[model samples]
Target: MQESVFCMVVSRTRLIQAIACFLSLYKTMDNFKVYILCVDEKCYEFLKKINFDKIVLVTISELNREDLLAIKASRKLNQYCWTLKPGFIKYILTLEESIKRVTYIDSDLFFYQNPNVIFENQPYDSVLLSSGEVFLPMYSKEVNNTIQSLTGNFNSGFISFKKDIDGLSCVNWWDKMCVDSCTSNPEDNKFGDQKYLDDMPFLFNNVYEITTQGVNIGHWNSSKYKFTVLNDTIMVNNNKLIFYHFSGFRIISKYDIRQVHEQDRVNTPFIYQIYRRALEKIINDVEKIDPDFKGYFTVDAVDDN
Candidate 1:
C-alpha cells in the first residue's frame, strides 16, 4: 500500500514539474520549484525576485542537515569535491524522500528553449546526462573511461530520474565516484565531478540519452553547428536548442557579445542571443530582490573586457 501511494505521488510530481518546465520556457521564470537545490545564494536571491512566493527555494543547509542520516558517510570526503557534494547530496536525499523526481541543471546554464519537451518526450526510467559536444573533450581520457564504466554513457549537466531507490542509488554512486580514493591519476582531477558522472546510465535500467541540442549548448566547442535566430525564436539545424550552458565564459551585459572565443563562434548566433538575454534577466532580477545586491558585472567592464 505504501509503495503504491508513493508511486502515485511521484507521478503527480512529475506532472507538476512538466507543467512548470513549460511555463518556465514561456516566461523564463527562475521561480520553478525544481531550483531548490542551488548552493549559490546570489543565484538563489536573483531567482527569489521574480516569483518570490512560488520559487521552490531550499537552502543547502536545510537540505543537508546531519539528521537526515541519509548520506552521512559522504561527509568526510567532502574535501574531494566540496562544491558539488551539497547539491549532489541534496539531490539524493530529495529523491529518497519522494519529494519529487529530479533533474539537475548546472548554475552556468540558462533556459531559452522549453525543456518540457525534453522531459515529456523521453521514455527512459532515468536520464543520463553528458556534457554537450562543446565541453566533453575538456575532460581527460582516464576520467572519460571511468565514467563509461559507471554509466556506459557520459553527461552531468542535465540528469533526469524518477524518484525511487534506484535514483538514490545512482546519486549515491555518483557521490562515491566523486570521492573515490582508488586512483590518484593526475588527469582525473582536471575535469572534477563531470568526468565522474559519465558512466551514470549503466548503474540502473531505465537510462535514456538526451541528444546534443537538448541541453548544455555553448562555447566549449560549439562552433560547427549553424544558428538561426528569428526574433525570439532560435534554431539549430531546423530544430531549436533547449538551453545553452555558459561554461567558462561570462556575458558582460545582457546585450553584450560573449567574451569567450571558440572555433564554433560564428555559427551560434541564436545561442549567443540566448546568453545575452538570460544574463540581462538575471542581473535585472537580482537588483529587484535585493537593492543592495552588487554583482561584479557592469555594462562598461563587460563590454571592455
Candidate 2:
C-alpha cells in the first residue's frame, strides 16, 4: 500500500483549528501521516506537548531557506503562510524519500470521509488541484470571470504533488515564484500564492483537476450543491461529502461564532453545527493545556439572529 502523507502550515492563532483538522482526519482515515509546519514558537511548543501520533511537527526555522526569512517582515501573516505552502510541500517531498506523494491541506479544513477518494484513480505523476470555481447561479459570467482572474481556477487549500519530474518542476517553480513576491495585490494580478496555481496545468504535464464535487465543498460553492444527512453520513450532490473548508468562519467568543458567508449558515447549518461542536471540544482541550490560551478568539460582536 502506498503511504498517505499530508502537510499543513499553522500559526498560534490557528492552533485550535489545526488540531480540529487533524482530529477530523484521524477520525476519517485509518492510516496517514500529517506534517504540520509551525509558523510560530507558541504553536510549535503547544503542538510538541500534544505529541500526536502519526503527526510530525516542524518549525519554520527548520525550512532553512534564507529567502523566506528575508521577505517575512514585508509580507502579511496570511501572505507569509501562503508563501510557505509550496516550499513546505517541496521540503516534505525531498525529506521523505520513501513517500511518493505529498498533499497540502489548509488548517481550516475538516474531513468528513477518507480523502483517498481524491487520490484513488489519479495518475501517479500528476499534480492534483481542487477547483475554485463558484457554482452559484447568482454569480454572473462577468463576476465569475473576474473571480477567476483574481483568485485563479484552483484553490491552494488542497494540492497533491507526486514526487516525479512534472510534479517536482511545478512545486519548484511555485516556490520560486512565491519567494519572489507573494503579495495580495490584485492590481498586479497576484493574490498571494493562490493565483499562481492558474499556471500549473499549462506549465506542467499531467496536472489533473479534481472534479469530485464532494472533495472540497466550501462556502464559495456550497450553495450550488444539495447537502443531505443520510444514515448519519453527510451527502453532497448524492456523493459522500469528503471535506468542508471552513474559510472565513471565525470564533468571536466562547459561545459566539461568525459564519462570514450568510448562505453557508442557511444552506449547510448541519455542517456548521458539527464543526462548531468539534471546535468547542478542541478549544476546551486547548484551554486545559494552557489556562490562558485563547486560540483565535475575537472580541467582535456576532449577529445571533
Winning model by TM-score: 2
Best by lDDT: 2
lDDT per model vs. reference: 0.47, 0.83
Give the per-residue lDDT digits (tens) of candidate 2, residues 271-303: 888888888887887888888885564554222
**TM-scores across all candidates?**
0.63, 0.93
* Candidate 2 residue 18 C-alpha distance from true site, Å: 0.8
How much is the lDDT of residue 93 in candidate 2?
A: 88
* Predicted candidate 1 versus true structure: per-residue lDDT over 6-123, tens digit per residue: 0101111122222233344446533344444433465445545555343355455554454333343444221222334424544544544444456665445556665656655664
Cα deviation of 196, candidate 2, in Å: 0.9
